[model samples]
Target: MDAKGSKARNKGVVACERVREEQHRYHEQDPQMQRVLEENYDYMVKHLDPVMSQAIEKVLLYQPDQAADFLAQYFRGTLEVKNYHYVEFQRQQYYDRKVRHLLALAMNSAVKDRPDDVRLYFADFFDARTKFY
Candidate 1:
């Protein structure tokens, strides 16, 4: 990975770890904070763009076992949201970089385990992108 990709991946791992920790703490706390967290999570889920969600779903379904990898990629892709200095260009670059990274990771794993499915997965990703954009 390049410097940027490495940094992005690290950020993603940190974010996931934080989220998990926060969720655990919230569960241990009173019901109020838990309710608030649930509300916020629900709102975020409800507002997600349908096309983007579908694309992610397609990628996840392509290899269910790689869901964690995909989530890591998606998290890395959106990590710029935590940066106060993030600009539109930077956000776009991050998004593209993450998507490509995620795809390549998945493709490589598929090629290693089931080489014949690599082409099918690529075709599925291509078809999904048409709808994603």
Candidate 2:
């Protein structure tokens, strides 16, 4: 476990540390700009890398004649798809929670031996499950 942890840390954390040291030296002339850059470094790496890396990889593979235009369209399409999936995910989560809640209520009703409550909860659960599906 220790060896694996050290190896993973060496791979990316070392690169991050080296980049920070270089940023400090290069941006020494502007302390404020350096601070801002340091603050955003992690954010850029976390959010931008996945999206930009894919775009760059495709650009390298295709070698488009107009690289800028190709990248522009690629980013637009990517964002559209991402937005769509995000919305769909939210809907799915909501339905899942509703179904789970109804099922839990039905189970509780059964435990209490409340026939009417059990029937109501089960009815609602089946209705939601069918509606969502």
Candidate 3:
């Protein structure tokens, strides 16, 4: 950006950061926020049990005797997916146009869908985001 554009953007960033800080402070002190946070935590923990059961059921159905292996694989899988954006952004930080272009293409292929395709589609996003890792 030119000098004037850069200055305006910096101001906007600073304003956003200050507003976020204020929100954190308000959440820390507000009783309503505290109740809402606690309720959210309770809801999340309550829902997790059924999802965990279903995941284990699905895994066990695939390989009944491989529960231990499944858990090990699950841990590694979560680790990789958790770090995907970090690694992807780092790749962006260091790579040139061609590398980013290839990354985008590979990403698209990984999640590609057609109307006549047998795989699942979604409302929130149009692509199937199944991980091969």
Best by TM-score: 2
- Which lDDT values do the candidates have, in the order given? 0.48, 0.49, 0.41
Candidate 1 residue-wise lDDT, 63-108, digit = tens: 3223333444343343122322222334345446445565555444
> In model 2, where do residues sit more than 4 Å from their true spots?
1-34, 78-133
lDDT of 3 by residue, 1-133 (tens): 5999999999999999999999998877899878867865554356433334453443433432223333334424441223222222233343342133333443244234322221211211212123211
Off by over 4 Å in 1: 30-133
lDDT tens readout by residue for model 2, 15-122: 999999998887776887777677556544554445556755654445433333344455445322222112223434543543334334434443444333323433
Which is superior by lDDT, 2 or 3?
A: 2
Q: After superposition, how far is residue 42 of candidate 2 from its true place, in Å?
A: 1.3
In candidate 3, position 85 carries an lDDT of 28
In angstroms, the error of model 1 at 28 is: 1.0
TM-score of each: 0.22, 0.33, 0.25
Count clashing residue pairs per candidate: 0, 0, 0
Clashing pairs in 2: none
